[model samples]
Target: MSPDVTAFGPDFPFGYDKWLGHPAGLGTIPAEKHGAKVAVIGAGMAGIVAGYELMRMGLHPVFYEPGRIGGRLRSEPFTGQTDIVAELGGMRFPTSSRAFYHYVKKLGLETRPFPNPLTEAAGSTVIEIEGQKHYAERLEDLPPLYREVAEAYDAALEEGARFSDLKAAIAARDVARIKEIWDPLVDAWDERTFYDFVVSSEAFRKLSFHHREVFGQVGFGTGGWDSDFPNSMLEILRVNLTELDDNQRFIVGGADQVPKGLWAHAPAGPMHWSPGTSLKTLNAGAPRPGAARLFREGERIGVTDVWGHTELYDAAVVTCQSWLLTTAIDTEEALFSPKLWMALDRTRYMQSSKTFVMTDRAFWRNRDAEGREVMSMTLTDRLTRGTYLLDQGEGRPGVMCLTYSWMTDALKMLPLPVEKRVALALSALEKIYPDVDIRSHIIGDPITVSWEADPNFLGAFKGALPGHYRYNHRMYRHFMQGEMPRHERGVFLAGDDVSWTPGWVEGAVSTALNAVWGVMRHLGGRTERVNPGPGDMWDELGPVRLGE
Candidate 1:
């Protein structure tokens, strides 16, 4: 467990944390470019991060958000209860997300270990699969079959991907070694699915079919990943290699506070803005209406809000889900190359739904007659693929995410009302905890989210499919606009979708930094010689290009 193993890329291994912490600051814009208005579409993590950096660099970032400012980092509070919240979006944050935690530390927000399965924070875990239920305090306490499944997956990673060596390389930040092992993996696994990798592995070949099934249901980190079986093996490898799933934590107040904090936080000494100037004040306390249309306005980029208010910006960073450009916003075709447009359109997003309920207390902590806790953090093959119990501490109300499912499982509840969804989840939990009366402990209206149903976000986050590496490479490298035609250079993309690892806040934060670099360079600004940005290291450390 080397401290340096933080999401220092398997693709494009640029140290974003170091870049952000550099005393020289991000970069300097020319006096003429000072106060230049840049339209940041969608005030999500990426948008806020990019806007915050741009503002620090003497640029004025005018945010256009259709919905709330926090985007997918949504934290919905229970009715009449401000402190308690349902983390409808990114609830878990891994310590490896050095760049994301940079802001978290800056805001002085408190965090505690996420109660992932088999961890001390979870206290206990219950695994239910194929109608069989098992309770355990840790992996060792589970049945032998469970241990065999876990070992087979670990052996499979080592057999196929050389897991140990590669993880060590990442931990050491050995740039050449990382690319040496990872570049070939991209070529080998990009065209294959995760299920393909698991089934084809020599290690799994030695195990029973039941073992593989268990591996999918009770994954190594977090919970089930069967929903992601059809995704590119390269995608899964990136998550494993970077340790994105392990050592997870959750924000104390809420995940949304990070973005909201940045929105109101003014840099100690911004280049052009006054000392008290902040993004909140820059936009006069609220963001402009959601961007309805994006088009080129001669040399500048023009953004039309939902209210028909059009404004031109020196540069624009589109931080919303890439699909929104096609489904929600009317983006001009000329702004992106045909190949780039294809990538943006082809970039697949995963569907996700979460049903949460506020509870009377941390009642799950009570032990039953058998001495086992009344309820535990749950993973199952039932309707509730994963159930998390969030303890707000003794004497305080707790929150329970009754169900967190993805893809097929998530879509099953897409059309159902919140009440019906809750009922369905409770029914599923009842089967697992036969003696537990979950509904009796309920305290408030349940909260549910079907990300795909929202027009602003066509899906939760990007989940690359087999043979989609070219698309991902195209989107990820778009920030290096030095080679691009002038018309397409000013408008940039930033979000988890445009990053190597989607569905992680680190991706959003890292790509946002890329956009900040792109915008700075687009505006005739340059990073200090002492601190080169992502764009500055593009040629040597950019993602590998695969043949057609």
Candidate 2:
């Protein structure tokens, strides 16, 4: 960030500022008349872990990222010519995550460890069904009505890996039993997207009963999507005994050094990072009683911006990608309620893409033999999107890899035309390596984030279907709605859509440690309610049916 952020003007980095740091159970708010004036909105990683717990309570928080800050879990700046870190975007971090390994041991950082970056499955992953292919290698290789629908897709991923003791046995006002059963069993097993779960699964099987891209050749790790499974079998059972590939590490240099270390202890002139400035509207009920202003992208919220510049802070925590709250901004009808803006206008998102290559593990030890895919493979090709293993340690032979593109909503929107995005990355690399020969290492061309072509992160992570946490837990519970009791004091709401497990990064660091224990119970701090974790992690794909 050395001075040249697009010749300045929302380009940031001339001492690139962004303020609002301090979290780890918050501590800072102590300067004025109810001085805890936060504003946080998408600097990613759930607005950098709820702007580091609202600038450690001495509250003055002010982040607002329109772009760049580890949202797609980025990592570029082409480090020292390749020991390989060019992780152009998020992948591998689910090492069982005990509170994301205590936020990487409270930011000392370094989670490098891997006994098996998943190199096992070798053959038989063939499935087509009606059109006919089916091969079978395990779940009785289907055909008993697809092995009773592959035992109900491994009992919907073992009831989406046992819901933290049914969300610590509900009763947070019965979180409506996560809309009558953990949001449709986590969108019918891992956040919906197939013509939106057409009752009793018409098809899309394969959870290690082979074929249907052999769980994308045993690699494309993440979970749910017909049944893709193998984001390293939940990273070999979340890496370290309940999640640990050394805390799925990242951020020694980038992952935007976690909101540049929460904008280096933020708290100055309420944060703002304009960037190609955009947002345009969101007014919501006159100028008083529960406020909400915004404006910027094409102006006019407070007549082209200014309720004192989009109302600084009496209340406004946005933190983007709530389906960009229905395209960038604008919802009126009192900013919320009409059943919360028709549940944030039918909120839906799940389409992803990530490509970064520097290659030279001798191009995966000469692809086959020699190292026969030294582990981590998955590439059954729906335009080949999950190819893993991005090296970090050992005599390092310059190898960094990541090409995720899982269902990238037909090429993520916005002004395209670099030769039609290099012919859609040469037709998604001829549907994944068809006789190789992609005119020499391709380099730059595969950047199609398509979370519905951004109206602001309109869903990629944080999906949740079915009853989706009982009707989108009030759009990720942005520290619950107001009625003024000092507008719900110490306000909080981390993301990955407030959890009972929302789209991962361990439910955005377990909803930023449940908003640093709700701003330490609004600075009178005290929490004793964890009851969520492995707890019989999922008694192997069996009981717990409640179908109604």
Candidate 3:
């Protein structure tokens, strides 16, 4: 059962990639149910993916979106530049996200290794802490303190989570071994914080407070994870075990293309629709207005758009941030059990802000007097937590993500305008590279996004807190509705927030596939014998349940 290091769950280890790639074609719906209308709320990645699959299965999926199509996979182009754009959200896609890559390949989209901190793709990295800066092309180039911190984290993993053995089981797709090791971890770490894990570890206990602080700032994989210090250790462990933060890449043109492509693409051979039928054509080109209300109207689900146009459907798939269910939409109380509602309402979303500027050229690639890059990928403790340089090409204008910050750091810029945000970021970077003038190279109106400020998205994505494993478990497995009361059967939840690995696009895609299965099954459809869907394997491979 050796599979790719995919999003195959440390929780629900269902191979969504396998189900998608199978020749069986995601199962078949009864001919009678072919044209059944299924309301898909939110036109984000999860919504678009679920809508696309349901459309292929012969069901008519009506989309409702408050904002743009891509959702969190936003690629905001600089003024007057299409190809050169800023990835506002969900920018980095790890190689382990096999399910997500499946669509990237399907759309023939080009991807390049994301310039992560210390990765060769970044060319070079600069770590700055407390007004002290250290430049390095690799880990070894830094001082011994950096190496010791790295080694301490590695040792801590081996000590705390059986890192090596669990990762091996995951890569091997050994479901039994994965559960045997990971299930118990749910109970052990679900109540603890990531900060607690490091402080409690023998490796970090021996090191000074500075080492732990360094580990949080210039953390492994992307950048500072200090924002996630208060999050559950189980969340961080899932990321480590699945390699969600390693070997990442970004779509060449824009990540927005993936969801837009899925929306416009005509599957090779769809179920009941004509050969040229697509989600774009089915709903008369654009999606309905944002879903303002969700309720069950006499066995069928009803979704009322903002414009007051209500539509009834046999089933509905909700892919928006869970908070919307309570805040934005008037979701009927009877639609879900009290426990499920608590999970949905209590789900915590983290704040994130990214400010990107289009440069006149790839001037950062220029060398300084010391023959080093003038400006390298930066990780600092300043207001700008992480800064990435996006080199378009030698002659082409480059997109510079001047600052990417999360949680408290993100909230700092939430109230500031784009100009102020850019100015603040420049002020911070000026201290690190005093000689290089970043503002001088700026070419276009700088773009920025504080996801929390956007009414459509309350926050960037879910960041599970301690003791919230039960909440996550309830939401992630809500797709399996066999035993649920009939009143709650018609509507299903799908989104990154509804998954164990929130904030990762892979989780969004995986959960959407689950909702597709749930919708299919609700519509009286079943997968072929050769390819069992997630629902079909639920009892055998569901996520480990934590006792109350």
What is the TM-score of each predicted model, taking all chains together? 0.99, 0.30, 0.99
Clashes of 1: 0
Better of 1 and 2 by TM-score: 1
lDDT of 3 by residue, 1-548 (tens): 12357677889898888988998789899999989999999999999999999999999999999888999999888888888889999888988999999999999999998999999999999999988899999999999999999899999999999988888888889999999998888889999999999999999999999999999998977888788999999999989888898889989999999999999999988999999899999989999999999999898999999999988999999999988888899999999899999999899889999999999998989998899999999999999989999889878999899999998899999999999999999999999998998888999799999999999998999999999999998998899899998988989999999998999989999999999999889888999999999999999999878787
Candidate 1 per-residue lDDT over residues 1-548, each given as its tens digit: 45668899899999999999999998999999999999999899999999999999999999999899899999999987887999989999999999999999999999999999999999999999989888999899998998888888888889889999999999998999999998999999999999999999988899888888888888867998799899999999988888888999999989999999999998899999989999999999999999999999789999999999898999999999988898889999999999999999998889999999999999999998889899999999998999999999989998999999999999999999999999999999998888888889999889999999988887899999999999999999888898888888799999999999999999999999999999998888999999999988888898888997
- RMSD in Å for all candidates: 0.9, 20.8, 1.3
Per-residue lDDT over 36-135 for candidate 2, one digit per residue giving the tens place of the 0 to 100 score? 4455556667666665554444344455554666676666644345224555545455444444444445555555432122222222233332234333
Off by over 4 Å in 3: 1-3
lDDT of 3 at 265: 97
Clashing pairs in 3: none
User: Among these predicted structures, which one has the highest lDDT?
Assistant: 1
lDDT of each: 0.92, 0.40, 0.92
As a whole number from 0 to 100, the lDDT of residue 179 in candidate 2 is: 38
